[model samples]
Target chain A: MSNNPIGNVWIYIEQDGGAIAPVSLELVCKARELARELKVRTEGVVLGSEIPESLIATLHAYGCDHVFVADDAALKLFSPVPYQKVIVGLAEAHRPNIFLFGATVVGRSLAPRVASRLQAGLTADCTALRIDEFEDKASKRVLKNKLMQIRPAFGGNIIATIVNSWQDPQMVTVREGVMALAEPEEGRKGTVTPVPVALAPEDTAVTIVERFKQPSEVNLKGAQIIVSGGYGVGSKENFRLVYELAETLGAAVGASRAAVDAGWIDHDHQVGQTGVTVRPRCYIACGISGSVQHRAGMSESAKIIAINSDANAPIFSIADYGIVGDLNVVLPKMIRAYRARV
Target chain B: MSLSILVFAKQVPDTANITGQAMKEDGTVNRAALPAIFNPEDLNALELALELRERYGGKVAVCTMGPPAAANILRRALYMGADETILLTDRRFAGADTLATSYALACAARKYGSCDLILCGRQAIDGDTAQVGPQLAEKLDLPQITYVESVEWVRKGRIRAKAQIDGGYEIIEAPTPILLTVLASSNAPRPVGAKRLMQYKKAVTRSELSARHGGRDYEDANLLAAEEEGLRARGLWIYEWGVDDLEADARHFGLAGSPTKVKQIESVVLTGSGTKDVPPTDEGIRDLVHELIEDHILS
Candidate 1:
């Protein structure tokens, strides 16, 4: 057996303007489970400008045994250079057994850089993570402290389980909203370690010129209900029915690749293999001929409602409620009924 | 000054047709069942590089690391407008994960001398790791901007790029000698130019020709070398390099250098208990909404 003792599990707490990103907290919850399996403590690594003490306390309540804070103005905006250098510095100082990040644009960019710097293996866009033991077929040796990183591969057609047994930090970036959030214990207390960030002027190569959010951008991860359209939506003008129904339900509007490819909707609203994966409470598919690629993204929702003209659409197989009709006729009446009820 | 750019692309198995022995019993990919195609996002990266060359007056060098068949993408890059193409092929480079892949790619990049910028697709659809570009940037000690949607401008040793974040977009300004991993939404790749396609349709790497002439032990080695020189003179040669050419340590290549291992693969099928059929009538729609709300499926 290798004499290397596994260290603490680390969570990269991504925050904007001091408030923690929801996905970061979710990762903290997942870290807690992994910590139990590895017999180690879970630590949250926060790198930002002026992270509040209250936020650190909240992290403690969420199951982190400790919070490592590197508050610096240089980290105010996420730059791959500085963020990566500082994170790598911290990792080099305090070795972590495992590190997990939210698979956001920032996380996805930073994790790989850190992994490479440390010569570690990283798995991205993982949907599920767990710790398991495995016995090698040839060596007959049992491998311990293996993080089973499960993700959809080969265009979401198969689920692949990857393991980084030879690396020090089993690193991964998980998709947002895919993991269950742990209940925060208000009074739980943990240590906060303040690490000094060493940044060189040269590391600040990429400077943010402008930043803004688009009003039309759909936040499907946070949406409790998603009203989605597919190829059967026909034209860009017909997509308004999806928006109107979404407005009545106070939900987000999503689309399949066909509608997006046809210019009926923006790529940001696309839901499928090459797009965003959502696990909302209810997923409403309007005129969607559900391909396996599209279904992979929404099949995790608590409830699914498929509306299509053809009764044989593949979406009906996994949907909780299947409705056969033309969305143009059935959608308007449902919107009117909901609006009138409101 | 015009820029010198190197773009990394991969030819991955098209997963859209995955079926029938997609995974081997040992938990590795079954490559035989799947047809290979250039990774979709890499085409977007290539488009960006070609656009950069058209506007800034630079050369775009395309490279891929795989078997001899991977040269197919280098030819496609040529047909699309790449100025130079290289194939990094070696049997020792098989079974490499992202860590080893980035290492070997970094070696090949260094051997190509220097570049003002490096471009790569955000991720390959097969592994879907999205780790190569960032990892390569680290090995090369270059700043990387990922999820790039467009390049706003490039001048005086700096490049302004527009990239996508979770909620919206951020325009970032970085110095030259940086790396950018482009997203699929960046731009529509142009189809192969007819004239260029005709010129490069026969472009093949030296090793590819060697395989065609019998085996590595062909009796006409000097004759094959002369033919290769003629091909190079016509600007139709695809540079091929193996582990020996790059001087890469065998211990740091292929399965030996890879840290991660695939433990298992399971074909996933989304199945529910059973779906309830709702009528197409207005009353049925209303009842459905009511039922959804009662079950907390809707607010």
Candidate 2:
């Protein structure tokens, strides 16, 4: 019914080592648009050991009006308690209208603690964020420009729109790659202010012993074409057909959540609501009976091809081309045919 | 020294294997059509707790907050060798978001007294929010370690565990009275122990006992008390508490405590476009490949 008293739209500028996480910049672009609608300024908060001038500059180029830096050696490592304390302290002092965080492993872990401390509402893994005029039908009152948080409801192909209409400092964690990356305007500037992170001995409870960073082999998001398989593709051995077709086309491979749950493939290549969401140029679905959750991730693909034995499979309904046949028979033929053309 | 480990669990709808009946034509979910299950990851948490108790000569107690029916998961926990179980239930606790849900849990946990450690699944699959465990830690002012894969050891008032990061794993250690949200990859959950299952099969909470007695019409309080007395004497009585038992602030019980509210729910409606079907023939396969190449879809 009432709005938060006074605040600007704020984004948590997440950092790994020295570079700013891409999602933080993405939020900056979105926050700029949102703040413009609300007629407020956009601010960002960065916590790390040594604040980088380039990081602050990059955020400004994307549209942050002001940046708050909490630099301390304790803040260097990503420990839950200390990180939570810094964000909570900053949020309490500023009282932001809306706060955002990346739905990365760190964000998912930290957002809740801060939200709880601030008694703020938090939505996780939001696919869509919007500002809308909400009407409380029961009260017969219209609340203007409430943050509409949208995510997929589990158990079915349903979308739920949640609102933190009753709370101050509405918070939401957005997954990476969900928003378009903003282009930088080199030399763009913003005001930088320092926020002190004072941590108690209790704050640093969990000690990190070591870290071994390994490069991820799968890059489904960057791929132009994806040859994806599903449970209908049958056993792990039969998946060789799908892999062969992908190799022939020089395309990356993906799998449905069901395929990953069945232990036929790893989690990184799984594409759907619970996994990675990809919208490649050409998406070839082999024996994949697409559910609404699966389609939510890839329905925006420029071209779609569906191959399934069941003619009535839901995937065919959205496919640019449909082939009612066995994947085992269809994949080898596709490979052979494409080879002939090459 | 023995360890007192408390495990928090939840009974959630099995959302993974949704059948056609799970959805209504109106696009909203028909929740009754789906089966209620012990949230998978919580089982992993309980398994870890059971193992710790076995190794350290302590007790493993599992707690859950939900409707009266949620006692089902607590019983399931007992079947897996949990020494004790708690069900915190009340109509006032309905419609709680993760924050409010964690509040009720922390209150019930406080009533249950302190333990050396707290364990729970990273998150429930129903919402996949992964908020409750850490939020509960905040409410209790305890330290937390999430995404834990394995516990290396617990000795001299400290627990060492391995937790997963985005690309790698980290070994972390924390003092007693800490919380760890376990991951399913940590260890395979042991199946129900036949001896324990048969032993705890008769266990039921006060609400469940009332149901079995055919509401209040068939029996009076005297008969109910007698039945409960029998259950308690034989260690088959499950602990039950509601909002009043925990002395919770009325504001923090449910919707009033929740900062978030569901504004809208819509079914994903996909409008099919023109679909061209290709014959699975030798000639058709070659022609299709040629068309893709012609369109420059293939480099």
Model 1 preserves the real interface contacts to a fraction of 0.81
Q: Ten-residue segment with the worst summed lDDT in candidate 1 chain A?
A: A1-10
- C-alpha lDDT of candidate 1 relative to the true structure: 0.85
Model 1, position A226, has a per-residue lDDT of 96
**Tens digit of per-residue lDDT, candidate 2, span A1-342:** 115355789999889787887678888888888888887889998999877788888888899989999999988878889998988888877888899998777887888899988888899878788899788654568988789998887756688999885657989988766766768788887788898778998888678877766757988888999999998988899888888899889899999978886789877788766667787889999888887667767777888999999997789889998999988888888999999879
Model 2: per-residue lDDT, tens digit, B96-137?
Answer: 998899999999889999899899998897888999888999
Error of 2 at B139 (Å): 1.1
lDDT of each: 0.85, 0.85
Best by TM-score: 2
Residue-level error in angstroms, candidate 1, position B237:
0.6
Off by over 4 Å in 2: A1-5, A137-140, B217-220
Q: A-chain TM-score per prediction?
A: 0.86, 0.93
* Stretches of candidate 1 exceeding 4 Å from the true structure: A1-4, A137-140, A213-222, A231-235, A256-264, A267-281, A287-297, A308-314, A324-342, B15-35, B211-220, B269-273, B279-299
- Candidate 2: TM-score? 0.95
